[model samples]
Target: MSNPDTSSGTLPSHEIIVIPPSGHQDRLLLLDQCIHVRIDVFVHEQQFSLDVEVDEHDPIATHFLLRLVPSLTPIGTIRAYRAEGEKYYKLSRLAVLKPYRKYHFGRDLVLALHRWVNEDAIRSGLQVARVVCHSQLPVKGFYAKYGYQPEGDEFDEDGAPHQKMVAYPS
Candidate 1:
């Protein structure tokens, strides 16, 4: 589905602003907005514990945030990072506000991460590489829409069932 502004009708390019990973302190401050959305969706809405919400990977991971145009309200977030001595990035913490989910905000966030992964691959002197995520069982189809396939057995993550989904970024 095409993204539509809150008021209805097609959203213009300017209706959305995506903040990509850049500097150090600036990114950290902006990441606070992303963490807010994650807490709302993962901890509060989904009843996950706060302890599992944030982890050590956060500091080094590249983050992205999507905000409303004029209001600058953060509505979605995702992160990408390669594991220690690993080549592929692990996409994680993808979330979109409940009311904004109908606008395909999650799709936009994932695509933005993919673009970042592609760029990172080029910077590392490669064409593209594998990307993976521990996708919640319920959103398996959603991840599949972006070429991710379940590659392993289901397991528990933060008390919820999850599957290891893999994809190749391009």
Candidate 2:
């Protein structure tokens, strides 16, 4: 179902803001909101351990925060990082607030993150071949809608079925 305006019959405007990489002075601006989204979705709702939900990668991964316009409250987040010795990025910790899921925030976050990564790679003269994610099994089709393909056999991750999916930047 689509997210509909409650009173005026219009949805609220929103935007995605990319968090600077670790060590940047502005990096902490959205880090709390990003962690809030992850805790809500992955830890509390999805039964993932707090330690697992907030892991080592969080400090280094590039994050994107979705903010509702006007109020500017963050409601969704996604992150990505390049693997050592690899020519692609690993996308992870995508989470949308429960109340904002109907607005396609998750999809928007993914697309924006992909674009940001591609642009950065180009600027740095890095040849990034693809964006990869370990997608929860039930949502594999969601990633497929964005041109991601399953790369290998499905496996269990944090008690949920997961599949390695890959998508090339256009």
Candidate 3:
């Protein structure tokens, strides 16, 4: 596998994009792509259970698809949704294919999600909104780059240790 750390940070702006639900593709198609990437990343690569991979939240969550430019092949995905009675938005299911990971598409994916959350909050007439993700132990630092901080003690989720990270992205 190529080293994501040593790869170049720059990519042609037109070559990669993170898209929300729209006429560019059917909603179901977009979601299906999201699930495929998650299965590849979380289930196959990380040994997460398939049963928990696609949960009830998927129906209500706003999903984003990351596609390669021109060909528009789906390579990564992410989602954000508000849980019942929760005051903040929950971001989850972020995944990028192994080869594509070296391109830093994951950063763009998370940024798009944060932009959506902030815009959604503004539309709802809210002054503040927090976005939280259950970050796996190894990538907790990845979330921290976007201002997310560990909020509590680490615990097990999906048979792996994780930390509940919170980010107040404006």
Q: Pick the candidate with the highest TM-score.
A: 2
lDDT of 1 by residue, 1-170 (tens): 23344666465332333444556457766789989989988998899999988998887888888887676777778988998889878999999877677668788888888988888888887656889999999899999999999997999988999999999966
Candidate 1's displacement at residue 104, Å, is 1.2
Off by over 4 Å in 3: 1-25
lDDT of each: 0.82, 0.83, 0.82
User: Number of clashing residue pairs in every model?
Assistant: 0, 0, 0
- Return the TM-score for candidate 1, rounded to 2 decimals: 0.88
Candidate 3 lDDT, tens digit per residue, 1-170?
Answer: 23333256566342333444545556677678778889988999988899999999887888888876675667788899988777799999999888677567888889989998999888877778899999998999899999999998999987899999999997
lDDT for 32 (candidate 2): 85
The best candidate by lDDT is: 2
RMSD of 1: 3.7
C-alpha TM-scores of all predictions: 0.88, 0.89, 0.86
Error of 3 at 101 (Å): 1.1
Residue-level lDDT for 126 in candidate 1:
64
Off by over 4 Å in 2: 1-9
lDDT for position 76 in model 3: 85
